[model samples]
Target: MKKQYIFAVVVICLTLTAFLLTDSSDTIVKYPTGYRNWTHVKTLVLEKGHPLYEAFGGIHHIYANKIALEAYKSNKKFKDGSVIVFDLLEAVNSDNAIAEGSRKVVGVMEKDSKKFKDTGGWGFEGFNGDTKERIVKNMYGECFSCHLSQKNNDYVFSQYRK
Candidate 1:
């Protein structure tokens, strides 16, 4: 009986160790808490006729932290730790008027020159809907590929306007 109990404990430990070792990623982007209060950079609605209306068509709002906002205003390279959030929400059209609907995803671009050097010094992530569930598996392939087109703008698509 004691031998069986010891074996069970060993098995549990090994299982836990394996699980820890097999976690998705240690460098996963953290959910941006209090991002709503950040500086509002812009709002764009990608209607059905828009060029990028398939994958990202929605009521997208951009928010930038202080560091990111400074870069936007200065037109300089984004400093490390500058975080920009893209809040993607459904566009509910009622009575020929459009309203903000449920959230689709909260996309984020966090600048870290050393950490994300391969991805043009930015880390990309997407939080599924309103929850903090991470959806980005391949930051370089899934995200950076599309963003590469905006290489001149520091791999950022949206431009800051007054």
Candidate 2:
């Protein structure tokens, strides 16, 4: 009887764990629809030999929404609801000219002070290529670790361009 009771408790615990893991709550950051039409903040290209070449080696464009744009231009802390996007593409160097190739990934940063309180009121997500499929398995360790260094800049790396 004791063994059977322990088995039932284990099963209940497993079921609760599965439910929590699969909870479709607001913690999940959605793909930023209509982000292309947002304000374009800046652009950059990282080629071979650069320290960040392996992971971020490519052409990248940064975009900001209204809230983020104002904060970026004014040099103020990004408020809640601010969003920034990092659009990366392959760099094609041909005919002595550099051009944009296929898209590599689309990274997004969303701010929600109350909801995303753990990650400094920001949630990071990466979409594979042009698809909406999520690629980031570990949000804090993978993305937040780098952003954490830019704490003074409200956990953002890109600066305002003239």
Candidate 3:
């Protein structure tokens, strides 16, 4: 009877552990649909001479969904369902003009209070230009660490500019 009880408890614990792990992984953020059609927040150019140019050299266009825009405009902590997209493209120079070139990547930030509580209620992902392949595999180590510095701003780096 004692052996049977111990085996049952172990089995129950293992099942619970498996369920919790699966639930967490299932909460991984999915690619936002029609993000390109969202509101354009701003555009910036990271030239070759800039300090972060090596890692992020390009033309960056920031976009925010309705949910995110509201929070940004209100200057409040973003709530769940808020999403921000960072569209990065190469910078093409022609004569004396510089313009956006081919896309390089699309970095995304999604806010879900419960799903991403460990990362300040934000999930980070970087998809390749095509938006099909995810380039960022580790959110906590690669993305969250940097954004953690901006905890006061709700782990967000960009500010809504007009």
Candidate 4:
């Protein structure tokens, strides 16, 4: 009887351990909803022959939620619940003028201080253009690494243009 009880306790502990591990991994960021209707921050074009042309050659539209916008405008760190979106679209030439084309990707950065403590309180994600499938499974190596260089600016690269 004692052996059986011990075995049961061991099983319970193992189950709890497994549950916690799975839950942490499942904390992968979710796509922010209704980000499209957020405030338009800026627009940029990465022209061909530019250094980042191959990776980000497109017409990029940046948006930010109210919280993020406030933080940007005030030059403060982005607060928790802040969200920013980078909408990338193809740039096509029509009548010798560049125009926006189909979307290429939708990149996002969500601020949750505790949940994303490993990445400067930011959760990064990239959604594919067509089906909105998430492409960036992790941000530590890819997104956060790049943004780390901008630590002086609160890990944000974009500035609010007056």
In candidate 4, what are the lDDT values of residues 118-139, reduced to their tens digit? 9999999898985569889669
lDDT of 3 by residue, 1-162 (tens): 999999999999999999998885568777877988999999899998999898689999999999999988998989899999989999999999998899898899999988888999999988898756888878999889989999999998888888
State the lDDT of candidate 1 residue by residue for 1-162, as single tens digits. 999999999999999999997675645676889999999999999999888788789899999999999999988889998999999999999999999999999999999887788899898999999898889989999899999998888888777888
* Top-scoring candidate (TM-score): 2
Candidate 1 regions off by >4 Å?
Answer: 1-26
In angstroms, the error of model 2 at 118 is 1.6
Task: Show where candidate 3 strays beyond 4 Å.
Answer: 1-25
Candidates 2 and 4 compared: the better one by TM-score is 2
Give one digit per residue, the lDDT tens place, for model 2 in 23-124.
865687789899999999899999999998998889999999999999999999999889999999999999999999999999999999877788988988
For candidate 1, list the clashing residue pairs, or say none: none
- lDDT (C-alpha, whole model) for all candidates: 0.90, 0.91, 0.89, 0.88
Better of 1 and 2 by TM-score: 2
Better of 1 and 4 by lDDT: 1
Model 3 residue 148 lDDT score: 94
Residue 21, candidate 1: how far off, in angstroms? 14
- The best candidate in terms of lDDT: 2
